[model samples]
Target: MNPILQARNDMLGQMEQMRELSAAPIRPAAQIDGAVAEAGVGNAFEDALRAVDAQQHQASAAMAAVDSGQSDDLAGAMIESQKASVSFSALLQVRNKLSSAFDEIMSMPL
Candidate 1:
C-alpha cells in the first residue's frame, strides 16, 4: 500500500484499539452498514462539519494558550489552523461542484 493509505489504516487501527481500551463499544459492521444506507451522504457531511469544527476549536485553544503564556507551541497552533482551513476549502469545493452538476442536470432538455 502507498504510505498515505498505510498510515490511514494504522491510524484507524489505533483508534479502534483506543475505543476498546476505553470500553466504548464499537458498532457492528452490519449496524454501521445500515446506518450508512439510511443517512448516506448527509451523515458523512455532518461528520466532516464536526471534524472541521473540532479542529477550529483546537486551533483557537492552542493560540489562546500561546498568547496567555500557558503554552509556547506556536508551530502546533499554526498547523491546526492550516488543517482547519484546508478541510473547509475542500468542503467548499465539493459543494460548488455538486451545485454545478445539479444546475446542469436541471437545465438539460427532457
Candidate 2:
C-alpha cells in the first residue's frame, strides 16, 4: 500500500476519534454556577492554546520522523504540518481581535 494512502487512513482514523469525542453531550452553560462558568471559559481558552502548542509539537515531530526515515508517512506529516500552521494562524487572529476590542473599550469616554 502507498504510504500516502496509509497516512490518509491514519488521519481518517483520528477524525473518527474526534467525532466520537464530539458525540459526547455538551453541558449547558446555564446549568453551571456563574463564577465557575466564567472560570471555565477562561480555562477553555488556555486549554485551546495548550492544545495548539501540543499539535505544533506533534507536527514538528512528524516532519522530523519523515526526514530521518523513522517514518514513511510523508503525506501524514505534511497534513499535520498544515494543521499546525492553520491553528497558529487562527490563534493569532483571535489574539488580534481581542487586542483590538480591548483597545476600543479602553478608548471609550467614561
Candidate 3:
C-alpha cells in the first residue's frame, strides 16, 4: 500500500476517535458550579461552522504561500484547499437542510 494512503487512514482513525471523545460526557471542574451539558444542537452546528471557517482561512493562506513560491511542495496546499472545499460544501448542505426543515415546520397546521 502507498505511504500516503496509510497515513490518510491513520489520520481518519484519529479523527474518528476525537469525534467519539467529543461526544462523550464531561465532568465539570470544581471551579464550575454545575455540569455543563454537551453542546446543544444549535451550538454544535455553529461550532462546526466556525471550525470549518478557520480551516478555510488556513487553507487560503497555505495556497497563497504556494502561489508565491514560499512553499516547496504544492501537494500539501492542494490537499488543504480540497479539505476546505469539502468542508464548506458540507456546511452549505447542512444549512440547506436546516432551512428546508424550518420551512416545513412553518407550513405545518397549528
| Candidate 3 Cα RMSD after full superposition onto the native fold (Å) | 4.7
- Candidate 1: segments with Cα more than 4 A from true spot: 1-37
Clashes of 3: 0
lDDT of 1: 0.79
For model 1, how many clashes? 0
| Model 3 agreement with the true structure over 1-110: per-residue lDDT tens digits | 55367649989999999999789877465435566556566987989899999999999999899889998657777777888999999999998999999999999999
The local lDDT score (0 to 100) that residue 16 gets in candidate 2 is 100
Residue 28, candidate 2: alpha-carbon lDDT: 67
Q: Candidate 2 local accuracy as lDDT?
A: 0.86
TM-score per candidate, chains pooled:
0.64, 0.69, 0.72
Better model by TM-score: candidate 2 vs candidate 3:
3
Instruction: Flag clash pairs in model 1.
Output: none
- Over 1-110, each residue of candidate 1 has an lDDT whose tens digit, in order, gives 45356647887999998888679666765675675454567777778788888888988898899899998777767766777889889988877887898899999999
* TM-score ranking of the models: 3, 2, 1
Candidates sorted on lDDT, descending? 2, 3, 1
Candidate 2 lDDT tens digits, 1-110: 77567777888999999999699887666654444455554587688899999999999999999999999888889888999999999988887887898899999999
